[model samples]
Target chain A: MGAVKQTLSLAVEQHARDRLARESEAQLHGMWVVIPAYNEGKMVGEVVANLVTLGLQVVVVDDGSADNTQAVAKSAGAIVLRHVTNRGQGAALQTGIDFVLGQKASVVVTFDADGQHSAEDIPALVATVRDEGADVALGSRFLGKMHGAGLGRTIFLRLSTFVSNRLSGLPLTDSHCGIRAISASALRDLRITQDGMAHASQLLYSIARHRLSWKEVPVTIRYTEYSRAKGQNVTQSLRILFDYFFHRSRGGQP
Target chain B: MIIRAVFLVLLALLTFYVFIQRRRLPFNLIVMSLIVVAAVAFILRPEMSDPIANYLGVGTGADLITYLIQVGLIFATVHYYTKFSTLQSEMTKVVRELALLQHKVERLTETEEQTGVGRDRGRAAS
Candidate 1:
């Protein structure tokens, strides 16, 4: 009986040590942040610099920018990937995701490079995925301090969220939030093929389709004059709706 | 009468062109030949369609032809729309592949440069 107790104690001690080692190792594991940019050379440099300052690995996919977005992002210490043509945001994001997955990123975050997203919010997104056991941590503007969006824009966003929720069957406050963090395993199971603004809704559809564990975290969205001028407007909402339904009518192949 | 003869001649020429390209354009030949035969029958005998239209319960022969043309145009529109969408999807795929290839090449070059610099440092240390 003493021998059995001793052997069990030894195995328990070994298991405890292994768990501690894993926890410590996880503390040092960094995440990959992918910023899909299109002619945002004016702001991509600052965005990349801010993310790099936060000690996160950043990759900027310049979606065939007519300007010098690639050069600016690279000079800001970000890995620069360029599309041959303007394949839109969805294609740019998929390119960045595949590249980072190849590099073995533990967690992946999709960030916008239009200077609307705050780098400080990235940690919450990453922590939600890391510590909270969530497959996807989506950032919501409505849940956070939403500044600079007018009443018209706010109503449009809410209407879009309603439509997206109905289509995806998931109650999400903001469906078009450009900031989101996902685990490597969840990303491996996802295939984003919308190749346009409709990707935001498509992501929600995929989350519901794959039954991924998701949680919403409040994140600040700084909509500056420059960002607002360059950002998508009400017209794009219509286009996005059309694209989503068209993709669905085609058996959701996109 | 002269107009009818002119149409008949034009149809004959079209038939000849279709026959010459029959192997390469079998479906087009059959469709065009049918159209020509129908036009010839309509011009030669305007009263022939009355029985067919009556049998189909259409108001008149002219109305029946109009309805048939409308249906054909609608079908063509649907077919072209589907084709356009497929092409668009294919274009998106091609653009994505090209972007990925560009990224891969950049990564490969960066890796090669780093390795080359590492080799230089090792030689100096040795």
Candidate 2:
């Protein structure tokens, strides 16, 4: 039994090394890091700086923020796109993805402007997409273990995971994590019609409809005081779930 | 009382004609069913019409029921018309955005073609 366990461990280590090598090649081809900001002027600059240090072409889409988010992000050496009006997060993400595709980026990575996502974990997501031959790599907070999540947030994540898994048949442990990396082909095919929180659910449905290969990797999510306060409460979460079903029933895009 | 029966029969015939002419079989069938029920009730127990009206809070005969039904149908028609108007406005916004994006793409393609021509001339000169 001990020898068998050692053999499995060795295989896992070899697989990890192979994945790292593939990610290095993807990085050399240039990955566009897209941060969708909406009134996150305070945190957007720091997020852009961190991504720039990681050698990724950073593009920050300011979704008609009522603050200086665009100016700060531009000052931080990131390309900034400003919306004329407040189109929701999904629209902002679509704009950034369109711009990145125009720039001929090989891989596009999405990060939240709230600073909850760590730029250091980007390579792991890119590696998962490249090595496993997956179209998209999603960062999962509840995959291996829960880290630094409050009780309320933990319950919300579990309920969302349950609903998403049942609906998409993907068995995802985290459905709403903003940290994800998609290949250029997948990004080009994605059509985001929903403008609000329902866009997240729409993306998963699109992936399933297209029969795209995807995987979830464990990653740490930082919840600062400001982020926790601004994050969706239980009431908002239920509303988003109801909106997803209502829109689906109306024959609207996910 | 005989005059009222004749009037109801004419109304039922007109409704059936409208349904058939419009090809609205489902709505026609529903209205026809209601007319049949009203006709049977009138024929079976004509004296009970006043009591049925009072039960419906109409305080009158079948005439009051006809008035109430007409008002309700009109209200529903107006409500649906307003809903259709709202949907038209939303569609206009979506079409405008699509047109803008298409124009942007066209300009970008034109610039690329122009650059390609310049590069070809430079290569030939070299």
Candidate 3:
């Protein structure tokens, strides 16, 4: 009887896994994940492969990387878009968003290509947009958990969050998480013009400006040695602030 | 007197340059002209800036001239920075368009290859 019970549990687990996979596949139909990669040749392939395994459509905008990021991402099964010259992360994201939206995607999710974000957290973000009817679902690392975040990085992210919250008035805990789910309709009203890391804050300001409904969802970020190395530093944060204020002063348009 | 004449000539050259660049520069033409005129007044009279300087809390015409030049420089810097940023954005848009167009071409080629191969297979099989 005990042996039979173990067999039944194994079959039940397998059935449950299959059902969840099918549900996620159905939910991810008409969904496209946009990953803006700049010289992330070492990591983008694995990241793209993981998403592809999850039955998610992915587009990697290779922002004029000197490395072989284009080839790696292509081999990993991403629809690759290559900018002829180096544009900032914002520009790359815009390119991917435009391409996928043109492909008639119903939902668009901007994900980081540096392998900091986990693929498992993506479904909840999409669900918030699709099922909860939120225009934008922002991934908040503070709301969830993050691993290997040193004290300095933690302080920087929190400080930037405070500043972005004051500037955007959206009451966000983590304003710079790269994972977000934006419905195609909300995207129609949105345009990212910051062309740099400052795009994070600009996206929030945009949400506030358009009066779009947004929900902050818990998402985990693994700050591995690589991501920690490529992560934003104090100088970059200062540049982001300068870009935000300067762009705001210029009326936030090109 | 020679110094003043040199200054006037230099200002004339700058004004001419600004006029020629009127099409490209974001500087307000009228504002730039006004600045050139004021600069000429300061260089010629050398004391006309005193009353204005006093009203503005600047000590003397020479000091006021320095401050005004600095302010003008700052404004020019800001204008050029904005212009540069706009040009960068325009370039980014062009690059983005090129990338998208390239992707479309690739997709078309891919589709053609698959269909062409499938058609050949069907004919061969028959």
Off by over 4 Å in 3: A1-25, B1-9, B15-57, B113-126
Best by lDDT: 3
Q: Pick out the ten consecutive residues of candidate 3 chain A with the lowest summed lDDT.
A: A245-254
| DockQ (CA atoms), all models | 0.49, 0.05, 0.73
List where candidate 2 sits over 4 angstroms from the true fold: A1-28, A144-147, B1-126
State TM-scores per candidate.
0.80, 0.65, 0.83
Best by DockQ: 3
| Tens-place lDDT digits, model 2, residues A1-254 | 99999999999999999899787556657588888788998999998998877667888888778999989998987887776567677777887887778888878898999888888788889888877778999998877444467888899788887887777677788998889999999976676766667678888988988889899988778888877876787787677777677657667656
Alpha-carbon RMSD, candidate 2: 12.2
Model 1 reaches what TM-score against the true structure?
Answer: 0.80
TM-score evaluated only on chain B, model 3: 0.68
Q: List the residue pairs that clash in candidate 1.
A: none
Comparison by TM-score, 1 against 3, better one: 3
Compared with the true structure, the alpha-carbon lDDT of candidate 3 equals 0.92
RMSD per candidate (Å) reads: 9.1, 12.2, 6.0
Model 1 alpha-carbon drift over 4 Å, by segment: A1-30, B1-59, B111-126
